[model samples]
Target: MIVNLSKVISELESGSRPKGGVKDGVGSIASLGAEHLESNGGFNFKKVKYVPDEFFRSQSKGIIRSNDILIVKDGATTAKVSFVDDNFPFKEASINEHLFRIKVNTELAIPKFVFWYLFSNYGKDQVLSDFRGATVGGISRAFVDKTQIPLYSLNEQKRMVKLLDRADAFRQKRKQAIDLLDEYLKSVFLEMFGNISFNPHGFNIGKIADLVSEVKYGTSAPAIEKGKYPYLRMNNITYSGEMDISNLKYIDLAEKDEGKYLAREGDLLFNRTNSKELVGKTAVYNFTIPMAIAGYLIRVRTNEKALPEYISGYLNSLHGKQTLMAMCKSIIGMANINAKELQSIKILMPPVNLQEEYSKKIKKVHNLKQKMLNQSEELDNQFQALMQKLFS
Candidate 1:
């Protein structure tokens, strides 16, 4: 049977916080935002924010419960969904204005079944098809209410969920392996260089400007679906210091502007403007072909004093993140770390040969990671196919 999503849903409302917003670790009640919603249909509390106990008690709506589905309501990651499972760590939690809390009517449909359906490609397309706004996109409750859902028997829904759960677990294992490798690299870096923040090795300290031959910002050119060259945006650089060109747009630059805006091999790309948690993301450009970068990113060419890999690794480390968080200035909702500010931050300068050795080790790890990523993609494709067959 086909029906509007509103039929199966008992409650649908977005959350709200007190004016001036919540603070990190300020209160006992966990306050989830869009960032807490993971792409894998789960929550990520790696950086948890909180709401005051008194304020949480005052609100009647937005109170989180097990088996509830959450979706990002606005901004760049609009329509992202996550399910609050029984294993959720927080006993009392509420979401901020950026997320919508969904309660399913158990008698009509299963919560996880609805979550899986909304998380599917077909459902995502439906949700985003009516996406409104220019600078910050969002969807209203009307859109969610009108979305079509495929209804199935409780037994059939359970059967499909069982199959999907197994496939998702397999895919998650591969992702966990990749995460472990990243942790391994962090350990290796600590073992070799110690913590740069403490200057444990007594290495010479130098500002970023001293170690870089050039620091230049990217172009403000408009990107299209297809153009002469691939366009690199702030999102291209992952929080873990890796380049993700998979979701790339393209741009065409004038002859004179090409040399100014394009990123060459071995250059370090820095995301200068983003949310407080994501600002200062750094990655080394290893691709042979040059790509034009957007205005929000800055390209740095390392001098003989430092390697791009070493700098990127340092910036992606725990200490590096702390440093960035301290120095960055928040403007409106976004944080900014311009070229001048980035160039002034000091770094521990290790020996040239040591930096080269770290680079070589990282290369090997990246090769292995790429292979695993390929396998993960294949698994994900299969999972999506299964969903299409079942939900279509």
Candidate 2:
């Protein structure tokens, strides 16, 4: 049977916060906003905010409980959902204005099952189909009143949830393994060179301009879906100093512009403009193929004095991020660090040979990580196929 979400859901409403907004460490009560909801159907409290105990006591709605479904109701992350599991860190929590807390009738459906269903492509499509507003996209209560879900017996739902959970666990493990590899690299960097900010190794300090042969911005040409060469944008550079070419665009450049815009292997790409937190993401281009970079990115070619890998590692370090964050000029919500400013940032001048050794080790780790990523992708495909089979 097919049933509307409104039929099985007992509570489907959003919450609000006080006039001045939530404060950190103000109380034990967690006030979760859309940022706390992860795209992978989980919660992240790394930057969680808190509301006062007295304010929480006064609220009759938005109190979070285990098995409740929370959805981002507006903004860029609208329609994103997360399940509040039994192990949720906070004993008392509530949603903010930008989130909707949903409670399903346990007599008719399992909350986990419904969460899984909504997390699937089938459910996301239905929810996004009703998305409204141009500047700030959002979905209305009508989505819950009209969207239909496949109704299964409680026992059947339990069985499906168990299977999905097992498959998801494998995916999560793969992701964790990848994250561990990154952490291991960070540890190795610290062990070899020490913290760049503190300069514990007492290496000579110099500006990035001294170590780089060239520093130039990318082209301003618009990119299309199909063009002569792959186009790299700010989003292509991961915060961890890795390239994510999964979603790429293409651009055709004139012969004159190719020499200026095309990135060579070993070049360091820096995202010069983005939100303050992500304004300086740097990655070393390891691809052999020709690719054009967008205007928001700056390309840096290292001289014999420095290695691209070493520079990339330094820029991705905690201290490097802090430096960029401090130097960047914020206009509205976006921050920018021009090529001149980036080239002027001071860096520790480690010996070239030591950087080479670090580069070699990083390469070995990257190769291993690539294989694991391939496996993870295959597992994701399998999980999605299963979701389609079961939910569709």
lDDT of each residue in 123-236, candidate 2, tens digit only: 888888778999998998888965789999999999999999998998999989999999998888888888866789899999999999998899998988789999999999
- Residue pairs with colliding backbones in model 1 are none
Pick the TM-score winner.
2
Give candidate 2 regions above 4 Å deviation: 20-28, 52-55, 224-226
Local accuracy by lDDT, each model: 0.91, 0.91
Model 2, residue 307: C-alpha shift (Å): 0.6
Q: Which segments of model 1 are wrong by more than 4 Å?
A: 23-26, 128-137, 197-202, 221-227
Tell me the lDDT of model 2 at 31: 91
The digit string of per-residue lDDT tens for model 1 on 226-289 reads 7999999998999899999989999999999998899999999999999998999999999999
Cα deviation in Å at residue 285, candidate 2? 1.0
Q: Candidate 1 versus the native: TM-score?
A: 0.89
